[model samples]
Target: MFEGLSHLARDAKAWPFEQARNLLARTLRIRLTDAERDLAVVLINSGKTAEAVATFPALAKPVILETGYGPSGLPHLGTFQEVARTTMVRAAFRSLTDDAVPTRLISFSDDMDGLRKIAPNLPNQAMLAEDMGKPLTVVRDPFGTHESFGAHNNARLQAFLDNFGFDYEFVSSTDCYRGGVFDKTLLVALERFDAIQKVMLPTLGEERRATYSPFLPISPKTGRVLQVPTLERHVDKGTIVFEDEDGTLTEVPVTGGHVKMQWKPDWALRWTALGIDYEMSGKDLIDSVKASNQICKALGGVPPEGFNYELFLDEQGQKISKTKGNGLTMDEWLTFGTPESLAYYIFQSPKSAKRLHRDVVPKAADEYLQQLDAYQRQEPAQQINNPVWHIHGGRPPQEGSPVSFSLLLNLVSAADAQDKAVLWGFLSRYIPGASPETHPLLDTLAGYAVAYYEDQIKPNKAFRAPDEKERAAMLDLRARLAAMPSDCQDAELIQNEVYSAGNDAGFDPLRSWFQALYEVLLGQSQGPRFGSFAAIFGLPRTLALMDEKLGG
Candidate 1:
């Protein structure tokens, strides 16, 4: 893990040996709770290990990490999760291999898949309605930019990944089929058609089994993928005879874009063709992954190792669906939070399902900042356990903002800050010489705070008048603060004074006092540390604001 270090030349005797041993120990202690560590085992752990991975391609060839996308709809946050997580695993694998093993991430788009239904989130609904049962590459682009709907969404997906700075090569299923990329693989699948069927048949119902074939031909007449039964297979010719919808028998070469396999078989074909080393799928695809593994083996190819992560639930706790448009879109998240925050959220537990909604963004952003702030103080061992370490791919940025997003939102509300400039005006005074150029993270956060305040916090605000006892406490607190030196802006000192006022006022359960402060002053039931807020807001202005709130 530490390849280029000059620890041996250090003045301290035996220092190099001690450092080398510590580094070696860390490499051995690869068992971190970080999801990426577990996910990275795919590079080392082949799927199921039913047959040992002694010959698994990753151990020999350059590792290929693959992520699949169905171009039926715009890529969502769930899609981002897979790509980001896969990238994280790639980083982990690199760390494990000391950057010696080469790797490539392929973002494969299934544009050849027939359009089963129109996505509700897309435009030009009537245009899509006519294209049902046709391959997505054949459907007209609703956005009128790309050649087809599939291409348009593919571009959108690329743009999404590009915006997030992901490292991957995009591949289209249509290109693979038409350009002979899968020609040999298709022939292999055809030679073992019955073996593939043996893996797929029992899982189907009677009606489906009656018509099921590993290959779904693109009808020469209608141009739609036909689901009819295969009449015959000529293994030597690499062709299949299938009944088209019009009842006439059709013979077509399986290679060169004439046919595509069913979902499981298609997955297996891709694995065989691309020699994928690792991939990750959502929990719903567990059975499909299993079937694909068996089909891959039947084709005399090894199935890639994978991590089956839990699916995301929507606001109603229902499974997020592309067709239903129930989940939070990736654009919606970037609207309120930074991409780093979203990455931090994805870096968390993968086995457990998460509720994906706009409401979850704030907490993710705050937690991300908390991690970044803590990363600087942590040791090398503890740093690897920190999500920020993985989030930044081992080298975290040095400049971090200590002010929480919540604090910025509260500042936005209290100051009636209409834009980032207004917030900057307060921030400039609070932290002298701290400008947008020097601390861009805080500056970006100021803008986000303004947007969040306008969209989420402002409408929900409900300020209440404190009762008589609470009023007395507020009055005493204001008096205590008023007695402090005007130039003193110590948050801890201010907090101590505020606490004494609450206790001296005889309020039981100290938390209630803070809750009262939040509700009465901030127009919310909870808030940032009041001392920090007051210090940042300026004590004189805070006392003036308190008088206005107390009606004094």
Candidate 2:
């Protein structure tokens, strides 16, 4: 599907932005006008309302695109999809139009939401354990703050994006919305309260009772849902009020038929209120996005356009979410590989597809560099012409010798910190005795010292002996490793120790040391070379790891 679209996206470059009109005609198996295609990218890039603005023959106002996520828990890979895609749209519009138009990417973290389920793979697993099945709205943070579970989750999301390198302004429902920016929209939604209630009640699968809030409560509110200042309703003023438990009413001013609407209707209201043009979301929200389109016509406003991308599936076949805690974290992945690899993985597919078992960290940096090289060298047609290029634009490798991780770490972690000559000398050994071609990603290793080696030492439980001779070779290597000299603290001693271990195990001490070590450490008979492994991990950690393994 992307292969075909790339052709159009490329050609769309030559034609009057009308190319987006025919872009997905054949791919999505749907027919749309040039306006629709342009609107789709404009919407997907900005939000529904932004697309409407982009279609205007004259400049009306700076296009507004409000991107938001429900802060159910810590931000997950899904959150990145929301913000990054929005950022890409903004970037693309700037690139495509020569900066004649400007875009605003507004991200809302729905910290006001109640906790649903704990994300299975959040870094602080023990912290989120108590709130696994609780309401996110009511759940207290790990720090025992008055902040709800969603606020804490939002903070994590904020940190995640900061780490992932997204440049966008973030708004928390707890902060920005509380100021009453959406009061008119909320009131308009409030007026439709009963009708919206009727529209939603039947869809509740019998688990929900007939209940209504001046605000949208996805489920029936049992206790104090109305206690918060931003959640209460004021009957006398014909408005929803925010309040404290003491019942001090914080009135939000409202107007513009703001007193009636449901979630779907409100989506259209939000677009008009914020002047949003595009917003990309998951397929789960298809019905919601569709309903907004209809409500837009009813309200005499244009519906913001949207693109629905697929969900990421984890190894367990469950959708990957920070709340689920089942997939990789941006932090964990960056430890073993480059940010570009991650960007490549996420941008490789359309927003709606699921990525499973995407490896962020390998056992060593060489393997990671090799993979990045493969991705870099891949044809433009292969990448689906997405934001991966927006990230790494196939730049040539940085000038340096290809050194194993440990040696490179040594250069960076050295006490002096500025020994370029020493660093170059260590890097020169990937070749038998000469320096090999350094990988572009190799420069990232010094900052990842602990992570690179820690990943390497993780037990590869799938290891098996080669043949009889290989098995004998492993045993000899083990014996050699058992006989390290009392005062041998240098890397050379570590290398000799590995060599002796191979000799004792009855294997030729060539590349067999790597296989032998693999059998010993990972239980696999193959892995990165021995010297390279030793280089990244250093003598102390490597020796300690071996001692823990062989007890010698």
Candidate 3:
């Protein structure tokens, strides 16, 4: 699809932005599937009236979409995916409702969670080792940037979210506990301890069940949040008797910040206390979510509606882990791709398992650019179906030049461009009168391509030594390119030359010829169409590159 568009641009002697837009309009359009429509109806009946109206507009309440985060490690791409996906759903809600309907996104951090194990990525690991089993709120910040380790990670999470312009209320579990915000909920959990245990204990193994207690008291002597057995539960006084680290029995109030419940009970209590309208979790947590919902029902509150999204995997298909440090980081992605591209990655078939790695960056970036181009020229109905419209909160930015990420990467390689200025110099030759200000998206892509090439492409790039027949074909192809008119329709001319070269080499044009070109030029068996690349790279430069590869 993009190759044909590039050919039109070369033939027309212009960018053919309109034709690109029309092509996207015809191909990239989307509509609500039956399941989606049913989900929209469910939202309407569940008092997300505004979301229903926005999604369907003829239909119409204030809604809360909650996403949870663990502050044990630096926020990664998985964290961003949850927020981005929730934001898209919120956008769908807006599309279905009148402007007056209120929606709030809550980015809740579980900073009160106990540091069961030290994170491998943090500095001053020895210091963290001494604080294991303590609440994250009390662990010293290794970087010395915040009051505690949790506080430092929370700040990082908020900073990344701010970079993306997300409007969200940040809630810290430590603050919620310390400020007595969970006091009532904590009391409710203590009174319903036996009932909540029944909902949770069936899911635990015998070994785990032996040590399980809904309430975990913070040890005053050791400062560690102890998960030991509760000796006595005084529901009347709202206190629990448990042994401290020193083996001395102590009576502590469960309310007013002395204790916190185990995660399953705590999750349900949070839903009951916060009245969360919607939430999401990974598929691995399905059983936990179900147990929490049951506990929520025991507490006389309904669990929020939500979906379980599949977890992300590394390129090797192994689960992405904060401890393993085995997947792409948020900063790495932002360095090489636009935030919208990351958002689009999250938006695409979120329920299915997807790989998050460096190699996926270019494809996502180009898809985002395609959506942006399509959104610009599409009619209102079609625009509604474009993911970019929802990604941009229904007000997508104006279209810029239709430069794809792969093309920019190739341009960086072909011109040996180190920066945007060098790239723009080469780009202006083909685009004619274009400037950075005139095409900000392409300009940004050029910078990203340079970074990506340096970090990802350059290190592993290896050119193959062509065989005798392939070497002769490349040399002849270079001669033909040199003979072509400088101002000719480069895409068509180069395509014909490549076909003729295949005939001369006695190779099949459909397969071996193009495969040979890719292996010889890009060191890959498949790549961006050579005809389109030649046109964009310019005939003279393409000839020079071919000659360089042919050792002539």
Cα lDDT tens digits, model 1, 1-552, are: 422122221211221123323322233233233443344444333332212123333333467789999998778877888898887776655554445446689999999999988757678998888877889999889889999988989999999899888999999999999999999989988888889999999999999898889899999988888777789999888899988888898899999999988889999999889877678898999999999999988887777767688888899999988668797877888899999998888877877899899888879999999989888898665666678877877778986885889888878888978999988877888788999998899999999989988888889999899999999999999999999987677889999998999999887998899999888887888877888888888888888888888883
lDDT of 3 by residue, 264-321 (tens): 8888878887767678789999999999999998987767767788988899999988
Q: Which candidate would rank higher by lDDT, 1 or 3?
A: 1
In model 1, the clashing pairs are none
Native-referenced Cα lDDT, model 2: 0.50
Ranking by lDDT: 1, 3, 2
**TM-score of candidate 3 to 2 decimals:** 0.85
Q: Would you list the clashing residue pairs of candidate 3?
A: 49-60, 50-61, 51-93, 53-57, 53-96, 53-97, 54-95, 54-96, 54-97, 55-96
Query: Using TM-score as the measure, what is the rank order of every candidate, best first?
Result: 1, 3, 2
lDDT of each: 0.80, 0.50, 0.76
Ten consecutive residues with minimal summed lDDT in candidate 1? 3-12
Clash count (model 1, backbone only): 0
RMSD of each: 7.2, 10.3, 8.7
User: Better model by TM-score, 1 or 3?
Assistant: 1
Better of 1 and 2 by TM-score: 1
Worst 10 residues of 2 by lDDT: 14-23
